[model samples]
Target: MPPSADPTVSVTLAEIARIAGVGRAAVSNWRRRHDSFPAPVGGTDTSPQFALSQVEEWLRRQGKLDEVGSRERLWPEFEALGDRDAMGRAIAVAGARLARLTDKEAGPDDSAGWLPGGTDLSDAQRSLVERAVGLAKKHGARDTFDFLLGRWLDTHVRQINVTPSPLAALMAEVAELSRGGEAGDVGTVLDPACGTGGLLLAAARQWAGTADVPASGAPLRLLGQDVDATQAALAAVRLLLAGRSPERESAWGVDVRAGNTLRADPHPDVRADVVLCNPPFNERDWGYEELATDARWTYGLPPRTEPELAWTQHALSRLAPGGTAVLLLPPGVASRRAGRRVRAGLLRSGVLRAVVALPPGSAPPHSVALHLWVLRAPAEGGTDAGAGVLLVDAADVQQEPSGGTQRAGRAAIDWPLLHRRVVSAVQELRTIQTTQTGQAPQTAQTTPAAPAGNADGDRPADHAVVPVIDLLDEEVDLTPARHVPKKATSANLGLRRSWNRFGTLLHELRDLTATLSALELSGEEPAGQGTVTVGDLLRAGALTMRAGQQPADGVVRTGDAPDDAVRVLTVADVLAGGRSSGWLTAPDASAGENAGGLTLTAPGEVVVVGAHRAFGAWVETDAPTVLGSQLYALRADPALLDPWFLAGCLRAPANARQAGTHASTSSRIDVRRLQVLRLPLDEQRRYGEAFRRLTAFERSLREAGTIGGKLVDGLTDGIAAGRLPGNRP
Candidate 1:
């Protein structure tokens, strides 16, 4: 029957470009230039598809295939299955095969027969199964599936969603910490909507890593449920592999059931010690009407529109006394009108322990930063719940120098640093919680409170301890940014140090002012100077404009060489005006070669943001960084244009207005259409120099303002604390 249709195992030109780690144009060039390149086996003229195997063979012949990972190699076959259900089943089957092999119950020859559904595997399915088995043998089943599942999700991120790995790790850490200093002990952990089981896997790994936890003892009990049967099956396989030991066939306690957790509780009687979940956001049809009277809505009946709140209550309901549940939720759920009463109830009962605001790009529906709701089931008579909620603004906790280009909105996070900060903050909050409850403080030294109440207690930077009574108002907004304490008391020595630095900055600012005054400038441009559109410059060869390509969600592979790491410059980096902000290592050469249409900036290239608030910057660094998507790079012909002058003109208000008019949407602008003054080369250089000096002056002003602000705050706190003289001159 037409060779069983070959499962339509083909990739489009764009996918080919990604596989090759080259621009689409480069792939097109290859098709035209190479006589032996694979022919299109399917698809339309506009988007031709080539057999994946044939293309890979061709790439391998060209020595361009080394960078492709095994996970990536299998992705095309999975996609060829055509339906997500089918794909999920195939993955589950592969996971089952791996599990069998790990248990020594199946040989390599029995892989196809080990498929979970008992269906005879097709040729394409068998090939995928073999590849998966190989990967499992090499990387272990849990890691192999993790890689495969990550690639699958990356390929269909818009269609399917899972918690980002770093966030899942953070949640797992918080959940463990909430066990109240019970070192090396992990009680039962549950994830209501486990998806591909990232959180559950994290919990299992955490338990395994604990030095004090005995590996020979009963394995950690892990319970999970998912609406998708395929996901639940995959989760079970992962747990089985993760918890498996040489002495045992499987982990002692692992129950991952298919079906909705909210609709049908698989482990209704089991109250978990920790509940960690990254629930789906903005789910509309969450059985609200049917479950309106369900007993789990102990806080309040979650509004029909607020399914996230339902998830919150579900998690809280599953918590044992003094058990903690950490849920990753949308920021809007904290302040949305529909969920206000539910939020208020949560606060009043003291179940909500802390709300930590993570930076954007932590997870999908990635339009805004997500919040972590750290909660505890109230003890009998509410004795365990603390008086105040810990609010931590961790949005700034991920600052790290990185290299490589990323998509406009997706900034790379320093997971290790962020995790440390988060863990430390949580520990600090625990200490504060203990102190507020009249228990002796464990971490920090404390003095008797001043009788006059002139000084505030010691507070961690970016964290606030707001009493529950204060949060029970009409608008119980738990946003960390809204409630962060404004001032912090400092020691006399620290205040003096800050004042000295402030004075130095003030002196520098004065010097900068004098330098700026010495520069001669005309109020208006020369009368005869004419303006030209950026389009004109392109046609005249004054500059070349290129838009950056949107990068795939994770790991860009280049070749077989393990050290092939590349840095990407992001829009955030461009805004920050120095150094690369993120980088990704190519898992293989094909992806590494594509670089997602990223162009390296030569000195004198100008980069401009293509969305939201439009701005531009001149490339000054000699180091190479790939241009991120959502930015347009303009490499000026040095003989005809000056980089700084072009950048300054592009960033001007008039050009921004011109760009706005040409915008397809209110937020997206075509930087190519911006207007520029057609000044002579020499004149442009002069303007460029002037712009450079102005930027320096602006930098000085910002420094002065920062130092001045810190000076005032330090002096004020010092005076109030009786550490500095209050007498004024």
Candidate 2:
């Protein structure tokens, strides 16, 4: 039976855009220009929600529901539950329903205890599950579940601490290369802190493509454990769906449990051939005191400040004899004083075979370049290869330019090139260890030679391999940049590029100054009517204000977002005079009834940031955006007030000081108290043009100053490094 109308189901503007196959701006325009559009049923003024039933009916009338399939229709209903745990339970129920299609004996409760009361589903939620099963019948279970899982992951990205696809693939590839054998050679793989089975899936894909199999044709074993029971259940269901696909010729032995691996390990007796992990970084309370006397600390007792070291040791302890484990850790663990002894012991024991430094933006906390440590369980009697460790510095490699209006300094990793470079370096080191094991070890006193260039000659060398002895100094520093030698040619080219950019910015600055000087102004003061307060204008229906409120922790995602996500404008963006640098997605925060809601600003709206040091007001000319905290969006009635003129009045120094609620510099401005001068529409336009021109001039000045600083820094560094011609410091 078709599900009846459920008024409780609600969706945000972003979700509406997805349903109608349109941009978020399109939905905002529909709300503004179409009188018949649905009014907000719930949510705050800043972010309003609409009933899903009404939105669907409206879309059907407009012929937009013709192409939206079952998957799209079911998502908003699942999200409307307004709780992540509830959403996860819905997914588990859906998975169980799909499983029944393959096995008549399997009941609705056959999710293997993935969710408590697994068979329990509300009528609305159960109806959504049936739609998911219908989607699976047509598109196959794997693809259907994958789409739902992908959306869920994207929504709760920060909380889950997902390992991005590129980095996961890179780690899997490195693990395969380290094995020095066929892809299917590894018998067992485990991820202790696995969140939604990203690494385990990567490992499965690595082995799935190969022709090799054991004599018995037994499937590879995949094991995982996570702290969150819901995530663990989702991970298990994800693996089951992937393994049960008809196209797959072989299956996998999947076992994912929920528990704190450091405190009470569920798989203490089992050792795996390969362990790939991106453990939680900077965790202070990871069973430090309880597990202090635990035997996993083979190298040394980990300090409280160095939780990554503890995870590193745990990964090592879980490896089978002659097995390999690859772990992603913060760069601080390589050289921090607290973990120095542990690092030295690993190097001396020869179990730490190599350390590869990945570029920033490869994973979470994108500001720091993370490192990958490759270790192998020792043979009996702890026989060391004594061939010195391989330190690969791939941090400075070329990167793909960041998409959207992200800041210029932020760039994404070129995954293919980086994977090839690091993998090839590791293979070369393995070859050396195999061929020269018995010979006396050679001491490497200085930085190793630069890597060889590619045969294509288009890409320069970016990684260097360093020896272990040189790394075991008084500080025992393992930072890749400290060991990798920079190419003189690259430095010179960078200096040349900076000089060219400096010249271009100077020309632009001159043009801006000329434009500002040419603007004519009256020499005498003109007569004006008394000013009107912003509150008065709002009460008179001449303007509408949406005050910015603090959003949920996961509302704003930094760095990159999905293609459908909208950019969020923050107070920092206003103060810096730049494009939006944050992202907004459809995720349910604690905003009840208005979960996943968003308010998008129009082109002519005024954006005001009232925080004392961050005070500023400007007319938004870019695409629609959600205002971040401390911001206010004012959309004026065009017939009454000009947006640019209103923005200028609010931004005046005296007006801001008068509106400030406190006598401190950091006090916030009460935007309602700000005054706007009363003027005729024609006269407002005249002043608006002047304000717009001055605003452009100030923005250009800031850009010019930034470029000038870059130019000076480049020149200074070039001279210091002796990269400039005929120059000495």
After superposition of all CA atoms, the RMSD between model 2 and the true structure is 6.2
- Global Cα lDDT for candidate 2: 0.74
For every candidate, C-alpha RMSD to the true structure in Å: 7.7, 6.2
Maximum-TM-score candidate: 2
Model 2: how far is 5 from its true place, Å?
8.1
Minimal lDDT window, size 10, model 2: 586-595
lDDT of each: 0.69, 0.74
Clashes of each: 29, 0
**Residue 389 alpha-carbon offset, candidate 1, angstroms:** 4.2
